[model samples]
Target: MNLKAWQSLVFQENQQLNCMIEDILINSSNMFIGDQPLRARKIYHDKQCEIGEARLMEDYFVDNSTYDDAIYRRRYQMRRSLFRCIVDVVIANNDYFQQRPDAIGSQSLSPLQKCTGVMRVLAYGTSIDAIDEYLRMSGYTTRDALMNLVDGVILCFGQAPQVSYIVNGRENNRAYYLTYYIYPSWTTFFKLITFPTKKIYKLFAQCQESCRKDVERAFGVLQDRFAFIRHPCPVWDKDNIGRIMIACIILHNMIVKNELDAYLHYYNPTEFLNNMPTNRQPESYTEDDGQPSTFSTEFELEI
Candidate 1:
């Protein structure tokens, strides 16, 4: 290219780069820069006053309105009492959430609203944007609320006897709890160990599969009932996501408890077993008699 043309092109590119740099610096400065300490302190005081004024609005939002009714349960997938219990526990640890505290801003979100927002994120599996209108919360605020609320709840409910089983693993817990008992049988051990084969292995496998199927069916119902946990979580933070997942499980347990009293009487295993025909004793055999030679009598597995 001609020297003159090259110089012109270079000049234009330099101007464009300068403009871009100016734009970036301006945007970055706006994001990070703020009022000085004195001004900020005054602003903080003003916010505290606003938050204090907003306190009076809380009386209008009684916990009994939707809380005392079935509609609240349907929407949040948790009973009012259980949710209130969460809010109460969370408030005790983090007084910033309470309706009235020894601190500043009157406009801050209440514990109830925070709890509701967190549940909405889990129950609907939606973005923070979804709750803005109903709860009148900004996406930024709601997102922060959700993350903190999950942490707070995990602090409160993470170690409860029921939720303690989360570490024992979900599927294993389901098997232990719902299955009530899993007998020590060859089929149960076959899949869990490295061992020899037997003619009865297929029968044992079938029995194991049947037991697993029962577990699967129960899990399927749980997942289908609570769609929030069934699908891939949209949350970015692994810790927050784990907490939310655990919170949903705790809520699920509470819901199950509410419904259990209605149908628990129908679950009469003793009656059902009594109706089944008794098994016949095997013909007398020695301790070393014609047991399956392929079976490893020494094999004993525990999970």
Candidate 2:
């Protein structure tokens, strides 16, 4: 199909993907702290900022913006406060730590904060102390609190599922059945005790071996691309380190899924089938005192 048709079909079949991409765009923009358009809108033009600042003053905290002499100075402080309030709102809405209230010190950690910290440690292989420092620079208060938040994130990831392929065993199963039942002769039957049950058994072994190799390749990529994971994270806190590992696993899964999906979509099944050799017929044989012997003189000569 053409690209347009493919996209149309995807949109028709999966609205969720479209919605998710939109959400990513919006959330990513909100997460940006630089002097970008989205950040500016959050500070000066957004109605939420006005209400948040009003509530800030009403709650008895000194409103720093009220005393600033210049509009720029006032806007800067207001933007900082607005950004902080937005972070708090994001955390409250997600409720990522509904069960772990202790992590955020009475409030929940924002999703952006949790995700960013997790990704940084996972992607960079940085130490928990380093993650703490990075987050602290962004306004997180304590290393202990960050570590607790990281632990909660890890718990969330542990609950996620591992990916695997489903083999329905159509032609593959038929071939196995033929080899094991219809084609087996007296000599082959005696050899069955030591040989594989069927070609499907070998396929299963090959699949598992391929999976192991894929995992090793993924780890190699991570180590090469992200230098920090090449060595142990220098952080002393185990919880923080665990969260980083979970985040890396999640990223790895995402990459694998994308690659696998592409392979499945574009790969030619005919070519794959052609690459596999035709199954050989079981050799005819005779058995004497439970010993197997083939009639072919070439087999006897080889022995």
Highest TM-score against the true fold, candidate: 1
110-224 in candidate 1: lDDT tens per residue?
A: 6666667667777777777786655655677678777777678667766666422454454433313213134355422435222328857665555666877886887686676
lDDT of all predictions, in order shown? 0.62, 0.47
What TM value does model 1 have?
A: 0.53
**Count of clashes, each model:** 5, 1
Worst 10 residues of 1 by lDDT: 172-181
**Least well predicted 10-residue stretch by lDDT in candidate 2:** 171-180
Model 1 CA deviation exceeding 4 Å by range: 1-68, 99-105, 160-196, 199-204, 265-303
Name model 2 segments beyond 4 Å from true. Answer: 1-114, 126-149, 160-215, 222-227, 238-243, 258-266, 276-303
Tens digit per residue, CA lDDT, model 2, 1-303? 999999999888688878888898787866666636643343422222224334434432356534433442222222233334434544554454232444324433334444444444544555544644333313232344445444553444345544444447522211111122345475423112233478887766556556657868877876664455678666666765666566456544544453464466554566444553233344666676777765432222222
Clashing pairs in 1: 48-105, 51-105, 51-106, 51-107, 52-106
Question: Candidate 1: how many backbone clashes?
Answer: 5
